[model samples]
Target chain A: MSEFKQADHKLLVIPGPIEFSDPVLLANATPGTAHTSPAFIPVFGESLKLLRKVLESTEESGSQPILIAGSGTLGWDAVGVNLVQRGDEVVVLNTGYFGDSFAECLEIYGAKVNQVKAEVGDIPSDDAIIKALSSKPKVITITHVDTSTGVLSPAAHIASLVKKHSPDTLIVLDAVCSVASEEIKFDEWGLDVVISATQKGLGVPPGLSVVLASKRAVEVSEKLTPQGYYISWKKWIPIMKNYEAGKPSYFATPPVQLVYALNTSLKSITSKPISERVEAHKAASKYVKDELSAIGLDFVPKNRDIAANGMTAVRFPQGLKAPDVLPKLAERDIVVAAGLHKAIVTEYFRIGHMGVTAVDRQRGDLEKVINGIKEVLGKNKD
Target chain B: MSEFKQADHKLLVIPGPIEFSDPVLLANATPGTAHTSPAFIPVFGESLKLLRKVLESTEESGSQPILIAGSGTLGWDAVGVNLVQRGDEVVVLNTGYFGDSFAECLEIYGAKVNQVKAEVGDIPSDDAIIKALSSKPKVITITHVDTSTGVLSPAAHIASLVKKHSPDTLIVLDAVCSVASEEIKFDEWGLDVVISATQKGLGVPPGLSVVLASKRAVEVSEKLTPQGYYISWKKWIPIMKNYEAGKPSYFATPPVQLVYALNTSLKSITSKPISERVEAHKAASKYVKDELSAIGLDFVPKNRDIAANGMTAVRFPQGLKAPDVLPKLAERDIVVAAGLHKAIVTEYFRIGHMGVTAVDRQRGDLEKVINGIKEVLGKNKD
Candidate 1:
């Protein structure tokens, strides 16, 4: 914690690799330790349990969590390789960039996908989704919070619809941007697979892809011969179980230092009421939207209610763009990402309000971001 | 650099997750940095360039290198998903556990595998490999230092033989344990693929899987409709190319902190003569093997000539086993791995002398390991 929370550099607010707590960063600096050492085994085992709590669940659902050394994209691959097999029909409730990428990944694994695409910053409507489910797809993937447009979809509502209409279909939610900062009830929502990365709301450095799967999902995975080796649930379920049971079994070497950092972040996230964390993110998000809205700015999402709690995507002012604004903010030591929605990439920018930047208000990170944007947008000239 | 070094802890001398350098470890603790920020872009780009040098390659061969946020096992899946499509015939030059594991991974991708297995502590005979190749396998895979047995297969020799017999077959080498410590001339050897991990000879913590591929292999990959998504070369090739040219292109978010650590480690490795580093490993390995043999112990390799330079797998003393000797060594603050071969897991142990532990004789890490083993093996009885 000795001056390592953030180095002598600008703030990172690009939605991922977010501002981390000092304790979490220090944990990343752990010395070289044996992956299977007695000291490390329990730490790993406990971290898996903590992941369940952060996901807002207990082990009673017969669900399991995984920590793999890869980015969030690997989670899409995991869902595709382990579940679809060849010629399986699936439906993608497309929201933004991540949804499109997931469709591409699933197609590579021989899944015949029917995409329900929404306009920018909008989620697929229930009417469209219900119509698509008529095909009796084997899986339905929804991006909980698409980083490309800061579009937060209603995951629980969709899962319930899926359950009522097609109970056999697995629900795969891409929650890369909405794990700790947003609400997720892995069991109560009847979610089957939740795929996320550590760089976002988890408040840890990137390197790990955290995936949670339900009992039925695992049973379905066990029956298929996965088309991938590293992406297979069959190879990893046993290892995840063994580690969670205080023993060491490895299908592949886990990332030791990254896992240490994840353990620290998970402990901090789960020790407090997760609902409080969600409230904090909501407050931070509202602050940014309110301040920007007063400046005559518009958001990518259809309305404030549909915007992601962890981030906001706002259109640039007339006669201004990212090239004109980002550098000015960087001059003030504030960093925000340019819009990533392929169609509107040059039209808007995104500000992330997840992790410590959202919860640890004492740091005034959101205030700095707001102040930086005001100065850059020429709103302070009056 | 500000006192982020290892604390009072035992030395890690396992086959991998070896003792990392202070600079590399400090880099791993880097504070939050945006993955696509100007500050991080060059670091990521330069790391890729340095990786090619470490693998002893030039772009002249139309070869490319990759660094993904995963363990070494992902490399196997990368090759399987990219090169050998389902139903492709491939031959595995089985040396030990790694060979069998690679075979299993390929088969999962629907490859038809013919494994030419070797006896314990040995590699597949050239005659056996030639016989297997006569059927015109699409790929010939070799484990360039099977960690399970410390048997270092002759990669160049095998590649040459494969080319002579099957002119169209691609040559793949798993160099997870041999990358920096062993000599691998990608261009000179006419090899198609060499897969490795960061934790072993690279002196970085475990997380990334580094792979180098030739033009011929890439061409084969370009023609295939890969079976998986995240591991596909088609998705990564352009991103790797863009980053190398100082342009930002996102495929999946890379592991930011791990890539920073790799950049530091790569700079240190590429700034000096790589041959001297290989020589250092050779000397350190000879010292370990000689001392153990003088004490009446044997290695898992058939002889000293075939053993891996980065590590040594030694049979336990006549009157002792891992339970007797490993704990004593641990008490002395030295950590070594027990045997992992399926048939002889209880008969031996492994000591790693790669990277800084092998190169920086000033550190005296190898001396500590030798002294600890001598003290524990009852060598002071006289």
Candidate 2:
């Protein structure tokens, strides 16, 4: 019964399910830990500490991490619905797909979205963003990395622009793939909110979405009109306060096994300097991009400086499409993602080198994919 | 970096995290499975089918199980907010502390609660419930087993009474700790909704809560006046329908690791006759109760028939407090729960024996707890 009955050998080469260390997988199997034991509280408390560390929050005073069950997508809804009241003006820096998703989530709550649109694969200039906030929005939202197109926005720099332009507007960052992969200084960047998922750089399985809120974010949430009950920040803050105070009141039952896995993953992050981990992802990304170049492939992002360090976006040769190249790679048991946004879908494919990914566990697969692409395109190279 | 840090080896002899099989623990460590793969869909589909079988529902009809994050407490909120609206009258068969909690959740949403109050450890009679529902309330809520006092209410008999008397009223059953340990026939008894969690009888680490809905329950939920988005039954029904149609939507990121563990635990339950598993729990309960009788202890609930097979409630001999007994048991690495409801706090303690509580797992631990209690109470054993 304990054996991996169905999917034992099939590797999950998705950006997530990256090559997790054996220890992280074993963490989910740790026997029963009391949910209310004094021993368990420190484990819970330590998890938040590591979370803040991973996000590179300089001051200890930002919002504490609130762990909820579900996906990073849920985090978008939570941030939008919790603080954005109906008729509120929210400025959105639309770098790629996820920024528009955050905007759509805001629209669901009846907030008006003002978009500062960046060209595909390009970062939004501080001037363009400053002009967008001229109308004085109550909130300014942006993505740290648009996973859809493998574009990394300069969140820390953009956040400073918001602070200088509109001090009253809350700055929310979607660091779903960038918190542990890229350098995100929440406190230095003047970020009011940050959100991420477990499956990404945190190196656990999917389920829990972690949201870190600033004191300003908490204050704004309290004054905002009640957005319904279950997903409300108003309902969550008190419960989280009580949990930190050692009175466990669960608004929803946490996925216990997933939390256990996260607890293990966070403990590892705290043990090492988080900056080293970020550098490791940078090194892996360089390795992938370097190998692709050795084989004569060009990167999709024209400006290489703006490319995400956790994953690489590369275009197929002019005649070859992703649909044609993907299956050829799959024949060797490798899986890479097709481009996600409307503008890039026919042009590029992304290879992730985040969390748990190493040159060792995956270099062979990466080589096979590179060789497969060469063999197929090599035929046309003649 | 993610390895299993050893938890304080405190055995959760509490109502949840009850002893689980070795294989079930190992099942959780299995690697990620595709959420949409044909290989993975049947695991989801089969789990739902087995759940229906355990509840004795029709394969073609009856209630279908919808899994979500959090504990059984969320299930109560989902049922209350979805079925009861402002000005709706709902009757609660208040047998213990959880009954009061169920009523409180309903009251939060503007439903008027009509409680058929029974003393702690007492089950309301069918006639009593019928009389309370004479006003034709919209729903009648009851706990299948109140973990507080280790009492099993007559859920089937009561659901039958609701059908006979208040035909329009939906019957909601809180089967949190009792579903896998005891018997619940949803279709045969015409119960509208039954909620349970993974930590108890399902024998996985806590996180997922299940709310199984009948056709009538779904209809009532759809008719609710302005259901909130997060906990809306309407939101779930469509997702569940897609799952049934062989495609599951991303309602929220599922706690993937916990889902894997649950699939393993549930498959074990359905591999054999469910009746045999219920019988095993019954045998274990009787064995523990027999040992308690040998040591001159008295059980709290009046009838053995109504005592929960999952947990047993017992009053210590006249001068002994459970506070003295609980820590001593903990010193021996065994954990047990003190009373939960206000009325029974000083007089009783609970020993849970569900979820992978086969004879081998229970015999040694049960004996250690019983002997620890004997040693603590030896001063007053007269």
Candidate 3:
């Protein structure tokens, strides 16, 4: 323990860019290290290996973890340019804002996107997804946890459906909001790809794009001519393989400080059983939703079963919009997010309870958020 | 100032991910801040403004600076997908490896590329570039400093030639290794785009791709239907405009911590006159080259005038290779990079003297590198 303390500030409870651990921040403060330095090769290599553990992927499963220095959106570009050729059909399970954006991205890359849109605050129905698969689309994308509405789709169930109905269809899960907070069994779920980022449940700052591609996804990509350079699998696959083998290789310069932070975070995350971490997030989400419900608040997700473990989206009291609630919470030194879905942007607000706030009970971050919301709502009631 | 110290580690003297100042590293250690937080908005806004100052671009010049979370190579993709349509003719001034890679990226996006080849360790000749311009190519790219060969192309001179011969052609400068270490007058030179990254001369960790595009370039990009979603100016232009006006905006999440580091570094850099910083690099380069020449060492760049000021590529003595020299320097606690250009991979090694190493004499880093190399080679003479 270095006894270094960060300066006190407002608690950040956004859906992503969640609160990070002290050791992770210290790692980010590292002196400059060359991306290909002998000292850094192992750090990069270890991070790749640890990502497999987090996603429940295995070398035996031929799942490769690709780490790139970009935001989570870059992972979408990776999938769009590499896996989807011109005139390929992709089915998007639309849950919220992210699903719509992902569909647009695939369309830009020449995929004829067939979106199975759900009603507001709900997951897409099973029948609609199966019907969309009638055409035997080349790939299907599911937002595992839609940040805009706090809806957690049945990813494993959807993958099972794809396997049963359209055996050749590849499953791509946008796990940006759910990676460490939710349970993701990559091999067991038969998922072809899981796209994520560092800031959400990984408990690091926002900079890296983490994508895991199964053996089948790799094969599909290799058959196509690459359309983009920076996101091409052909350029990055060898680099990732060499790094995970503890060798120095370069396609592009990795973000040294962020990778160090990720290595420190993954070590702490894998120190305990992943199931325990998922249960912790479940407990935190349950506690937050129960407290808000006691205050007569509604949720963006229609039911508890579909609500995400990492965050909660609660509708405001009658006659109150975001302006009436979000700033009041900020004044109490708590930071929550305004709603993102265009349909209900001003009607609800979101509170994140992932990573340290959910897993480490001693932090008391959940209590601070709950109490702050209670006090503010009490005043508004008067 | 706070008394926080990073742990002692080996000095990083690579071309990028160079030695960062303590304050910049401390900034990278920042607690998590929401990308749209009020406190972070100004930091991002100020970073955009300072980037303009560093590049000598002005508000009146209609030049826009875009900061995204990715490596320097991502900047090449941004240029490729945004500006080039099918069968657009492009002339690439091939100085070294990066030029070839940039040409490949453009071709992937459907450009018909014409590369003007240069001799090994030399810049493209003016006569060749003039002949290539006869067809009036849609765009021409110049690599400001090719890190592979340590050859510095005359960027301003190339822009002048392009203006005289092909006035309508867009000029894109790959300044991945040159910005902040060399002088760039964007508006005065009539340049349309300058692509760079944070790690090189900006003295920050490697996570950000900093690109400045002129108003004409933006207009040109708008005329073409976007082929990419993540790299599209349509999605990012509004976001950048809003962030620069101190408002919250989001297309994709910006790398928050790295942006903070960039702001701190740009403040320290522009705190002194930029000309003074350029002169410091020049002085450091002169000293390193003189010392090596006195030891009877040859350089990768054909002469001093065409050599990069931030780094030096020195050919090994007869009968010696990288294994005989690099490890010897490492044993003395000094680190230098091996050659990267394929044509001369084993014949030479590189030493970086930019950012704090060149600007802050108090650190005495340049002296350590010079002395360590001298001692190692002195023993080889035996």
* Chain A TM-score of each candidate structure, as shown: 0.98, 0.91, 0.97
Better of 1 and 2 by lDDT: 1
Q: Best by lDDT, which number?
A: 3
Please give the DockQ score of every candidate, comma-separated. 0.73, 0.35, 0.73
Candidate 2 residue-wise lDDT, B65-172, digit = tens:
887765677687677657877789989888788888888777766689998888777788777887898999988888888888888887878877888888889888
| Residue A240 local lDDT, model 1 | 86
lDDT of 1 by residue, A1-382 (tens): 5555445579888788798887777778777788887768898899999999988878989999988999999999999878988799999999998888999989988899999999988888889999999888999999999999999999989999999888888999999999998999999999999999999999888889999999989999999988788978888888888889989676788889989999999888888999999999999999999999998999999998789999999999988889999999998998899988889999999999999999999999988998888888778875
lDDT tens digits, residues B183-224, model 1? 888888898999999899998888899999999999999999
- Chain B TM-score of all predictions, in order? 0.98, 0.92, 0.97
lDDT of each: 0.89, 0.74, 0.91
**Residues B327-369 of candidate 3: C-alpha lDDT, one tens digit per residue:** 8888877789999989989999998988999999888998889
Worst 10 residues of 3 chain B by lDDT: B1-10
lDDT: worst 10-residue window of model 1 chain A: A1-10
Q: Across all candidates, what is each one's fraction of true contacts kept?
A: 0.83, 0.45, 0.81
Which sections of candidate 3 miss by over 4 Å?
A1-8, A379-382, B1-8, B379-382
Chain B TM-score for candidate 3: 0.97
